[model samples]
Target chain A: MKHVILGNGPTGVVAAETIRKMRPHDAIAVVGDEHERPYSRMAIPYLLEGKIAESGTLLRHDRNHWIDNRIELVEARASSIDADAKSVTLSNGEVLPYDRLLLATGSRPVRPPIPGMHLPEVVSCWTLQDARAILDRLRPGAKVLQMGAGFIGCIIMEAIANAVGKTGGSLTVVEMGDRMVPRMMTPKASALIRSWSEKSGVEVLTSTRVTAIEANVPHAGLLSLVYKAKNTKERVQVTFGDGSTRLFDFVICATGVAPAIDYLRGSGVEIGKLGGIVVDDHMRTTAPDVFAAGDCTESVDFSTGELMVNAIQPNAADQALVAGANMAGGAARTRGGLRMNVLETFGLISTSYGQWWGAEGGDHVEVVDEAAHSYIRLEFQDDRIIGATVVGRTHHIGALRGLIQTGAKLGADWKARLQADPNKFMDAYLATALSLA
Target chain B: MMNSLHIDASKCTGCLQCEMACSYENHGVFATSKSRIKVFDFHSTGRKVPYTCTQCAEAWCMHACPVGAIHEDKALGAKVVNETTCVGCKVCTIACPFGTINYVADTGKVQKCDLCAGKPACAEACPTGAITFVDASWTGLDRMRAWAEKLDTNAPTA
Candidate 1:
């Protein structure tokens, strides 16, 4: 069988390898739009931080990894898919026939509708090219203005902070939400993160929005015209929604991201309301013989029982496995996508799993120590833990994940004990999980 | 035949020899904090349970690794992290359900049990036989045989 996979991100790479392992002789081709070797976008922050070279971001260190696995790498963007003909047409007009197809075209950064947002001084920290542009602009004492404080935003902020900390630069982060990481963290948790970032010398402004950006001329009147003519130093004057302006060396928009599915408009595959391709438990889309995974697909949410996009790496990998196996004429199913996010911002680690925000009618318990910068909140539904949010502590925390994933019942006595003191979760987990085992 | 590390928690003495041995084998150090395998001291029940990477068939750390830093060692059937490629993002440390993979602050890289490339220093250092490297397929054989011996079918009476 011939398999054609789109988007050489982690999901596509993993699915291609899975197919190769299962059906060794099957012809496989992976299509990537980027110029660089297939690399992980997750490592872009590390690259910006000077933690690793560009080559270190490559998915496989071995030069012949793809060739050794007998998988072909096609460097081209997919234009459209002809489901009836079982063919995919590349932007370069090359047509490839396939017995199976996977759509793992991950996500693209969402560019908000702010005036002058498309200027060269502003870039989204998503791709390798973007990283290079940001790095070039980031000089000693550069004034960096970052938009958004969500998961990706916080990661980029941390990297930029580290980079600028060496040169005595300044970073100002603006978020529209009331707290940082509003989507993934609770209010109290986000407040702690904001304070942590502040303590690290990063100026974080929540509940703020940038209204407009304009190329800044050094002087406003006649001198400004002369300065514009010989504008060697590039800077932008950003207008805030509150009628205030600030000058920045460069602006980074990590506002948000959406699934890169514009090319699939005419395709027979069904796009869900969540703006991702809809797939079943087996990862099969509406189009016959076509599967979708990664950040581009809306799978079942384990907590809410609704189709939602849990666009984290672990979920992407799990979905890719199922898609790859089923595409290779094997049976595989996901237990539904679980929302998991673990982040380290300025050396403070925090994690949230499942429905971090408590479920409807669920009993919730929280233990917070502001001075110690430690907090733990457990959301319980009936006698089972459905979600959890933890900050500061990292040892054996996976037991929280273990209990949630296993969906084990704590019974009455254990439940009351946990409610009283959530720190005893490890003991509770050992007791309950062992009994179940 | 592939070999696996089998643990008998009941026989553990919490001497931490396995931890010291593991750290020395991997890091050329004697620091227990640097060991890949850790012995959890349950102060309440006074039970010490030694736990480390199970080297799962479908390892979460290997899959969750975006840069492909973690790979299966074909010879030892161990999932090992390539430090050169690891960005120290600590994503694998969180993905691991058992919390066996750890981030080393000194190196900024994650470390896990690689079974010492099949030698298994922990198993070799155990004094009470709480840990042992045995055939993967028959890890439960000794216990099974022990229980079978208790049946005493030759007695011919209850």
Candidate 2:
């Protein structure tokens, strides 16, 4: 048997190893477009923070890991897939035949349609190359402006803040949403994060949008001509929607990302409404012998019976396991994708699980202590916890996940007790789980 | 046959000897906070449950690691973290459902139970036999045997 995997990210690397372990005699090839060794995008933030070198971002540390595993690494972009012919055509004009195929192309940052977005000063913090460019421009007292405060945006903000904090530089973050990390956090939770960021020396502006970015050319005047000679370094003038402008040495756009499935347009695989490849419990696409996983694929959401792109590394690893097993002529099935997000912004840890926003008409409870910067909210459907959001507490927070994932019924008495004091989640979980056992 | 750490929560005394032993074995420290195995004190229920890495067959932390820093120790059947290769992203801490893997701020690396390569210190240091290193295939043998002794074939049906 021959296997060809696309997009040598975490999903591809894991799937390739799984296949090799299951069927060692089978020929396997992994395709990656990047020049660097197969690396994890999740580690890019650490690299930017100077906590680790570029080699630390690699998915496998050893240089000869692929060779040792007997997996072939092909450096090429997949141009198209011919499902009917059981072959994939590469951009380098090579046709590779495969008995099984996996599409884990992952996601790419979306460049919003704003004027001067292509300027060298404006870079999306997505790839290694982009990290290099941003690092090159960073200096002592360098003023940086970043657009977007979503999950990815906040991660990049932390690295940049740390880099600039030591040198007394300035960092301003703009988010069009009403609150920072609006998608992953509730209003109260996001507000607390904003304050924390502010306290940590990051100027956060919400409900703001950058309208345009233009090369900063000093105003044509005698004083401007004199200032231009002193300031030889090029800067960008950013215009906000409210007609406000600011000059920044570098602009980072982390607006959002979408699945890189454009190459699957002609293929028979189905694409979801959110622009992700659609797959079933087995991680198999609509087309036969084709599988997809990772941020590029949409699977059933365990909390809500809907298909969603839960683009987290854990989900990708789970999906890859099932996909690789089935691809190697074994049977496997996934319960579904569960939404999980744990983020640390400026030393403040926050997390959400399952349908964290709560199901419609569901009962919920909140325990907030604004002074201590601690908050815990539990969303309940009947006697079972369906979702949770917590901040400023890390010890045994995984108990919340245990309660939500098991969908354990807290019983009427326990439910009321928890409603009164949401911090008793550990007790509730232990009671329910222990009783069930 | 490989050996596995078997935990008996019912016999736990909450002395925290296992925790101190684990920390000292791995980090050359006596701090309980740095221990890979933890004893949870249920103040309300008056029960202490000691928990650590189960060393799953398909270890989630090992597979979810983007840097492949977590590897299986073939000799001990333990999942060990290579600190030098770890980038301290803390993804493994999330991937672990048991919450046994933890990040150390001092080193910026995640730590978990590696069964002391083969002879686990927690099992050796346990006072009440709450933790023990036993054959992997028969981790439940003692419990099964205890129950078997209770089922007398000659006992009359009530």
Candidate 3:
């Protein structure tokens, strides 16, 4: 059997290797559009911090790991899938036939429709090449501005903050949302992160948008310009929505990312509302012999019983395993994945698990310490713990995930006790789930 | 010089990104239960300690392996397990002072951290600069540098 895996990121790599393991003699081909080796987007922050080199971001340490494992790594962007012919046509006009195909094509950074966004200085910090470009523009005391404060944005901000802090540079983070990571964090939790950034001497502007970016045409000559506008001596000027302009040495756009499923435009695969390929529990798409995983595929959000894209690496890896197994004629089923996000920004950790926003008419508990920068919100449906949002406290993170994932019920008594004292979660778990004490 | 995983427990957030990366690299899965490097969460104290084999020079696991499956890779100073030679004896799992090595029921062999052949996934996946693969000889250098920089260079030569 011949297997073709698309995208070649974490999902693609895992799928290809899994197929090789299950069916050792089966021909496996992994296709990636990027020029560099398969690298983890999660590690890009470490690369920006100078903690690790470009090689460190690679999913596989050895260059020859793929070859050694009998997996062929092909560098090509799949233009379209001819499901009828069971062949994928590459941009270079190369056609490859496959007995089974896995579409692990991941996401592409969303470029907002702001004017002059295509400018060299305005770059999205997603790909390795983008990291290289950002590095090239970074200098000691560079005025760096980042847009968005979502999960990806916060991570990039952390790295940029570290780099700028070392050189005594100024860093500004702007997010159109009311707070940092608004989608995953509660209002109080997000405010805590903003306060932390402020305490760290970083300017964090929330509920703001970048209107336009233009070249900073100096009014005076080089010497006069440097002397007069010493602080705002950057090359590009950014116009905000509030009719204010500021010059920045570099601008990183971490606004968002959309699944890279445009290649399946005419592939007859069902695309979901979230713009991800719709797949069943077995990771099989509407198209026969075609499976999808990773950021490009939409599966069940276990907690909510709704289908949404869980673009996280762990979910992607899990989905890929099931996809590979079923593609190889092995029976496998995915229990689906819950929405879980754990973020560390400027040393303050925050996590959101399952439906962080409480279910409809559900009982919820909120423990907030604004001054301490600690907050915890537990959402419950009936007697079962459904979701949680924890900030500045990671001790109960694992236990919270367990309770939510297992759909553990905190009986009436335990629930009443938790409503009074939220810190008694461990006792509730022991009493309800484990039946201990 | 041999290197070790220098961990600053204070910097850990218990995110478990390291666990996912470790399992993916070694077992071809994202299950943290199969991960060799485990993050021990001290709930009451709110401390996260990423525990793994320190690859002691005088290794107890190596001495306790009945089938001589565990051998040190001199180049990396990591005691690697030869899966083919392992007899599922699990004697090394008990002999190790640190509960780092364990027996895998599926593979019927004991698995532990071998530093990923000098490139550990846990250290690589760490985001907060907490877990650093540093030179074993100077694990305390980073801390010492912070303290040394406070010296008054021109205060008094005498």
Candidate 4:
């Protein structure tokens, strides 16, 4: 039977590998838009920081390896699908018949429609082409201006600062939000990040919003940023969004990425409200023989039981395993996957998993460091550890991860551990259990 | 003879064991971003490359320094930067083509991969065998072995 999988990203690749392991004899084909072998998407910033060389971070296996395992890899864009006929067409007009198909078309970076966005220097981060294009503009003494302060944006600013600053180039990051990494960290955690950036020599502008981008010319060699700071009525040319209108050689908008699903629209496949393909518990799509996984599909959060879009590598890997197992006639269910993110920003390992987050909650606790720049806050409801953010010396990050994953409820005495060292917080788990019993 | 650390990026899995290893060794913490070794991702090309200081034979960073702060370590043959003497001028940063040499504003020193004083943590922590420490003379031995496998003079014809 012909089984086709779309996209060679984490989820699609894992699904292909899993299916082959489950049924060795089945005819399997993998379709990918990218011509190169599947590599890790999470390592993009490190590449910019000059940490690794150009080709050092390849995936575990290559296309040749997959072919050796009896899996056909189609290196082309998949444009449309015919669910009724059980087939999908590539951009080259090649149609392949399939008994089963899985959609793993991942996310694209969200590019805001600001003026002068079509300029050569202003670009967003996502695919390899985007990275290489940015690299071309990164000459010695060339200034870099970054827009956005989310996880990818914040991390790349550090990378760009390190890379450009090494070459005598100036670097600045402009963030519209009052705090950086709003989705991943709380205000206390963001405070730690702000301090770390100060130490790293990266000038960050928070509580500032960019209103327009202009291609500075005569040379067309630099870009100017127009922004307005919070609690101010003035529209200023704060070169990097602070009252300093500086010329920059390159401008990278590391805003964010959304799932790529334009191909699945007319196929009668159910799409999620958040722009991802809809899938059930087993990662099976509404179409009988079609399955989907990765950033392109919606998933249920393990703790909240709420439908959410999680386009990270870990979730894709786990979901792919389930999709592949069921595709091969094995009894594997996704159950649900947690949204886990682990990032090293400035010099701290910032992380968020499951529903260890939410903007609105009645129960919460705030902790901070006045001098050393550290912060940790645990938000709870009904005595269960619902969410937490640890900033500066977060020693037992794993313990929080464990508590969130297991839905463990904490006793009142556990609050005392906040005064104790973070590393010693794990020791409080048992004492709290004892006191409550 | 001082030996330079060699990297093989093709085998990297982006597991970050190398970065963790380096951070733990240098700062007694686990932070990949602060580590000397960095991994770059070419997402569309599906490439992740781990890069660090090549420790050039004729080091430009050493020559570019005004106060002779950057020097060569005889034991590991690494270009070492004396943090105490560095003025954080970043002149060497401009001279280096690869941008391996970086200024750390926190300590007011320039930081680069020192090969961990000859025992490189990145090479040790690489789980996929992508990086390994070897003598200065035999860096091309792996490539030779790969080519040697292709010789089929006496092989049975399939």
Q: Best-fitting candidate, measured by DockQ?
A: 1
Query: How accurate locally is residue A114 in candidate 3, as Cα lDDT from 0 to 100?
Result: 86
TM-scores of the candidates, chain A only: 0.96, 0.96, 0.94, 0.86
- Estimate the TM-score of every prediction: 0.92, 0.93, 0.73, 0.67
lDDT by residue (tens digit), candidate 2, A1-437: 99999989999998898888889899999999888889988888889888889988899987788998989999999999999999999999999999999999999999779998999999998899999998998876788999999998897777898776646588999999999988889888888888888988899999999999999888889999897885546488899999988788879999988899988988888998989999987889999999998899987888898988767887898788888888888777777777777777877878887888999889999888887778889999999999888888655555665677667789998899899998877667656754411
Model 2 - which docking category? incorrect
Candidate 4, residue B87: Cα displacement in angstroms equals 31
* Native contact fraction per model: 0.35, 0.26, 0.00, 0.00
List DockQ, one per candidate, in order. Answer: 0.24, 0.21, 0.02, 0.02
In model 1, what is the error at residue B29, expressed in angstroms?
3.9
iRMSD in angstroms, per model: 12.2, 11.7, 23.7, 22.2
RMSD vs true structure, all candidates: 6.1, 5.7, 15.4, 16.1
Question: What local lDDT score does residue A382 receive in model 2, on the 0 to 100 scale?
Answer: 95
lDDT of candidates 1 onward, in order: 0.84, 0.83, 0.76, 0.66
The backbone clash count of each candidate, in order, is 0, 0, 0, 19
Per-residue alpha-carbon lDDT of candidate 2 for residues B1-158, written as tens digits (9 for 90 to 100): 88899888889999999999999999899999999888877775788888777786657689888888999999888999999988877777766655668877678678889898798999999999999999887576444233322311111111
Q: Model 2, residue A195: what's the lDDT?
A: 88
Mark the regions of model 1 whose C-alpha exceeds 4 Å error after superposition. Answer: A166-168, A218-234, A412-417, A420-427, A435-437, B43-46, B140-158
Per-residue accuracy of model 1 over B1-158 as CA lDDT, tens digit each: 88988877778989999999999999999999899887866664678778777776667789889999999999788999999889987778766655678777678788999998889999999999989999887565454334322321111111
TM-score of candidate 4 versus the correct structure, residues matched by position: 0.67
